[model samples]
Target: MKATEVLADAYERIAEVVHDAVEGLSAEELNARIDPKANSITWLVWHLTRVQDDHVAEASGLERVWTAQDWFTRFALPLPAAATGYGHTPRQVGTVLVESGELLLGYFDAVHEQSTGFIRGLTATDLERVVDAGWDPPVTLGVRLVSVLADDLQHAGQAAFVRGALQRR
Candidate 1:
């Protein structure tokens, strides 16, 4: 199979998990942390989406949906406009509020659409191109995408786990 197809499929799986984790959850459930220091479903989904938006945008030279579509304004989060939840402390995680599950899904769907669109156009050569030079072996477009996918999948699963745990409690 082509690299583009593989990339697109990977994104699709992540979206499924993300949707399952957030769909039908009330605002309280989305925002509720399993413990005082744990991340909420809201935080996990938001962080994963933000990371995907930021990384994929950088790799594709496209604008992030967060700023391009003014989702930052919509969220009206207390933190800075650039906050993507990386290194967010427990206190900061508590601040990722949403009124409903739909808001979370809306943002995730926007990001997923943008991301898949970009990936569908990539050639193998494009994936081979270096996107970052700070790392020891540097980072290629392929590596960067895989990294993002791994992170997103892990967080999506965490969100799903949080949802199940919340329901159990």
Candidate 2:
């Protein structure tokens, strides 16, 4: 398989887990935290989606789905317009509650559409281009995309775990 295909597949896995973790869950379940300081399924999915929307948009030189599509307004969270849930504390995490699983899935699916579209068009040379220069060695498009994929997968898995735990509670 091509490198782009592999990347797309990796992201697709995150979407699968995201959907599984949130589908049919009620507001209370989605927003439930195992501990007072723990992350909720809602928060995990939203944060992962936001991070993907932010990073992929930056690397592709495209507008973030969050702002470009007015998702920030839709979410109405008491956070910055560009908030990606990075470094968010427990209180901040609780503020990411959604009315339903569908809202989270809608935003995630929108981001996935944009991310996959941008990624599928990239060549090996495109992947080598520096997307961020702040890092010690500078960050290439490939590295940045991989980083987002890893983060999204981790959060997705966390959401799944939270779901399982909540179900068994």
Candidate 3:
């Protein structure tokens, strides 16, 4: 299969697993503390969606999808005026506001759907073109897409781990 096709397939599979992971969770369960070092299921879902939005912007040369100034503009989230910070805690990252696991997963799937469309619109030629992503070495569209996919898979594992810990509690 071609590289674009491979990326699309990988994204679809990753999204499916994410959907399964949050299947039966309630808002409280979704927001439950997994561990001091870990995030809740809701946080993982939002983080995945945000990751996709950032990746899409990088790969398509577009604007950032979910800005800190408007975190709830999409996915039916309530907008927050200031939602940016850096730290290890879920609160520091603002992952604590995710009220419902179902909503979080649904929003994530929507982002995946849109991301797949964005990916499909690209040509193989589009993939190899280099862009100034404001990084030290810069990056290609294809590289960014691959990075998004890898990050998604990695976080999916993290989400599962959180789920397992929740089960243990």
Best by lDDT: 1
Runs of candidate 2 with Cα error greater than 4 angstroms are none
Per-residue alpha-carbon lDDT of candidate 2 for residues 1-169, written as tens digits (9 for 90 to 100): 9888899899889889999999989999999999999999999999999999988987788999999999899899999998889999999998998998888999999999999988889888888999889998999999999999999999999999999999999
Q: State the lDDT at 35 in candidate 3.
A: 64
**Per-residue alpha-carbon lDDT of model 1 for 1-169, expressed as tens digits?**
9987998999999999999899888999999998999999999999999999999999899999998999898888998878899999999999999999888899999999999999999999999999999998999999999999999999999999999999998
Candidate 1 global lDDT: 0.94
Q: 137 in model 2: Cα distance from truth in Å? A: 1.7
Question: What tens-digit string does per-residue lDDT give for candidate 3 at 38-130?
Answer: 676776766777778766866576655455324466444433423322233554544455556666765676677778888878789988888
Residue pairs with colliding backbones in model 2 are none
Q: Candidate 1, after superposition: displacement of residue 149 in Å?
A: 0.3
Q: Give per-residue lDDT, candidate 3, residue 20.
A: 73
- Cα displacement (angstroms), candidate 3, residue 86, comes to 6.2
Residue 125 Cα positional deviation in candidate 2, in Å, after optimal superposition: 1.2
Question: What's the TM-score of every candidate structure?
Answer: 0.98, 0.98, 0.80
TM-score-sorted candidate list, best first: 1, 2, 3
Score each candidate by Cα lDDT: 0.94, 0.92, 0.69
Q: After best superposition, candidate 3 residue 11: deviation in angstroms? A: 0.6
Question: Which residue window of length 10 is worst by lDDT in model 1?
Answer: 74-83
